[model samples]
Target: MKSGINAIIWEDSANKDYGMQNTGLKSPERTRPHHIAVLAYQGLCLFEFATVMEVLGNRPDASATAWYHLDVCSLEGAQVRATGGALVEATGGREALLSADSIIVPGWRLGPVPQEITSALLEAHAGGTRIASVCTGAFVLAAAGLLDGRRATTHWKYAGTLADAAPAATIEPGVLYIDEGNVVTSAGSVAGIDMLLHLMRRDHGVEASNKVARMMVAPPQREGGQAQFIEHTRPLKAAPAIGAVLDAIRRDPAGEHSVSEMALKAHMSTRTFFRRFKAATGHTPLEWILLERLRLAKDMLEYTDLTIDRIAFEAGFGAGDTFRHHFRRIVGASPIAYRRSFQTV
Candidate 1:
């Protein structure tokens, strides 16, 4: 029924390619290809929209294989202008929402969402279509009340704002993405690539997904639970006194450090040290210590072949079991699993 011309593309030699002349083959025509609908609006993030088009729209040739049929739809099927000063000609409108197997709402500038768009999304979900948002587009889903009581995320800068706006949805601050079966959300920019690759892997298989990734020159996969790149700001102090204590902890994460000892090193009483430390770092002494140790553990896990026990000891956790507990709690995966998910090797 089918034949392989190469590892990446296969066709039926007995017929004309896969789709051609194989009118009798139900599997080739009925399944495999997914109808994906992407939303377009004024002030859309061109990069985010292009990300979806790159992954789901660009294919080998129609005769080689059919993976996805993409419909770029704008409100009311009208022409929309992108933030980058380009115009988009959409193929469909709300009707595409009903026929799509999946819908993606890329990040758009902050504004009030039209009620019609929200209602179409509600209907799509009710019909079992998977809905996803990239970055601030989580706001659109939230406005639709689709992310109610769901653990979702967006860009770190807007996490607090979205949380306050959507009290019913749980806001996860710094993850790359979160897939809740029917509803999926991703963090800013590049994380959208991670989320779409995951969906591709789920729908097709690893080989097909990897083929696409290779074409795009992107990593084959990044787990949804991977931490977003968040820069922790250090407080400005009057002098370098607290800086010395912070430097000591960073220099030796494995060394035993107590608040009292740190206080003594800084020539301050325990109470004063606690107060100033909180002011300097916006975190309690214990919290900062744990955070530093976790950072070290993550580096070792990603770059080295160290065992879990060795990584734990070097990172100051002292025990493999404790390290795993903390890593899972903070990073959402075990050390081995996290490494497996993200390690370039």
Candidate 2:
């Protein structure tokens, strides 16, 4: 699985010629062909918007694929200028959205979102269309009120703004993305590529998405969440009562660790330690440790073929079963399943 030959592939003889002449073939007509519409908001990120076009628009023809039909829709038949002063022209406006099987909002520049775009997003969501956003575009989705009470992420730099705008939402500052089924949000800039490719995989299965990734020279997958890249800016002068304990945990996750001992080390009362841990990590002590352990387990799984038992111990889990449980809970897949799917190959 560590080799490059592990790519997943799928092909159908029926769609070999790429045309849907068989009107009676219900599956081909009703399902397979996805109509994707991308909202070309003003001040678009050239790379992010082009990422969608490259993957979905340049799909191979001559074979009957029921491939994607993509439309870049701007407002009122007007050409919206992109960031860095590039002009973008859409074939149509909201009409493209009304007909789309799904809609994507690519990253936008930081500013107030236009009301017209927000209203259309609400209408589409209410109508059962799947909606997603990339980077600052998540701001647009949030502005439309689609992210209320849902877990979402935007660029870490702007996560505070997103949370403030939609207090009903839970803000995950250092994550690649989060999928609340119909509504999904992604983190900063290029992470949008990961979210869109993932949507392709979820809707059309691995093979189709992989093909698109291959064509675009994008990685088929990038796992272990955006937290792996999150910097641990723990202070070095561990003098603060609670700060010392948190820093120690980072250095030795395999060591025996508990709040009582942590409080003792920090020379603080247990109750104070509990309150401060939450303030420090934006989560409970156990929640933070669990994520850290699972993150360690994922690294071992990716880099070595060590058995789950060994990984469990190295990751500081009480047992292999416990490690599997938390890994799946946090990462959304079993360790074995994740390895099979994402291990270098």
Candidate 3:
């Protein structure tokens, strides 16, 4: 940040524009997927694999204007078995990796990537294909010598492993994803979706990416740095009285629901409710409320045209300044910067 704003945003933005390719859903027969390849190593995280296929495999409505062609690649014609016993058919092998515009490696199984797999990845990198990984998939990339001297990230648990294996790569553990133009890496599991949606946004545009997210009935455009997931404290479930109070909290996230009044509503002594709430959700009622507010703030950032002040009120903050403070703390970015990065507008 010592550099000027222009210095920081310009060179960096151009590289970001390179690292990701967001090809909106398109017919394979039409745009031909720009050749997206998923490296289906043994024990690949199914959710991450599914995320890639679900995002990249679908052909757009014959009526829509874009398309993608997704291919599953493996080191050999080996039957790719996922962690949960699901068998995946890899239609292509190492040769397929060389034939892609983009290639992705999902988090590897509990051990190192086989040498053969690593070699294929390096050859693909040599061919100038954009490469990325989810979770420990970064290990595969690093093992192949592709990550050295680059800005990269992985599931925080394995970020240290990546740094140790490839001392040249600058490891960023807390962020959701990193884009070095030609190479990218993301946190484990769900961040894979965020990264894919980003690629779609880069290729097709905001409107196209949102359509796919809506198709899946999920939010589009979660910033790479947003919390992986928020744990909410539900009011006491065993106490029917307290259950009603919990429902009320969810119903009116923006309401002024004080803890003392909530205890009264549940007919519980304040001390008992406090203890139970902590045991149930691993957080206090206030902590849960803040997380919910952050989620709402994110939703507003993605879906609405509301002003920041209005979003603050809708998300239950006292006002704009308070909302900004909590948002920056929990979300790791300013309201405007978050919106600018994620919101279509």
Among the numbered candidates, top lDDT falls to 1
Local distance difference test, each candidate = 0.77, 0.72, 0.72
Query: Could you tell which candidate, 2 or 3, scores higher by TM-score?
Result: 2
Worst 10-residue lDDT window for candidate 1 reads 1-10
Model 2 ranges with Cα > 4 A deviation: 1-35, 58-60, 63-66, 76-87, 94-101, 123-130, 149-161, 170-239, 292-315, 318-324, 332-345
Q: Compose the digit string of candidate 3's lDDT tens values, residues 1-345.
A: 010101011011211222224433332223344678898867768888888888866555867544566789888556878888999988788777787878888887756668898787777777777788887888888888888988887776677677898899898765677777678788767777777776665555567778888887777755326243333345444466656766777778788878898888977899988887667655687887777777778878878899999999888996999998787766666788778867875
- Model 2: per-residue Cα lDDT over 1-345, one tens digit each: 001111122111111221123323122223446778898967778878987787666555567575677888886456888888999989768866766767888887778888888888787777767788888888888888899998899887788899998899998865677777678888877778877777776665667778878877887765445443444455444347667677677787777788788878877788888887778667677777776677677778888989999999998996999887777655645689778865763
- Whose TM-score is greatest here? 1
Give RMSD (Å) of candidate 2 vs. truth. Answer: 9.4
In candidate 1, stretches whose alpha carbon ends up further than 4 angstroms from where it belongs are 1-29, 60-62, 223-228, 234-284, 292-345
For candidate 2, the per-residue lDDT at 117 reads 84
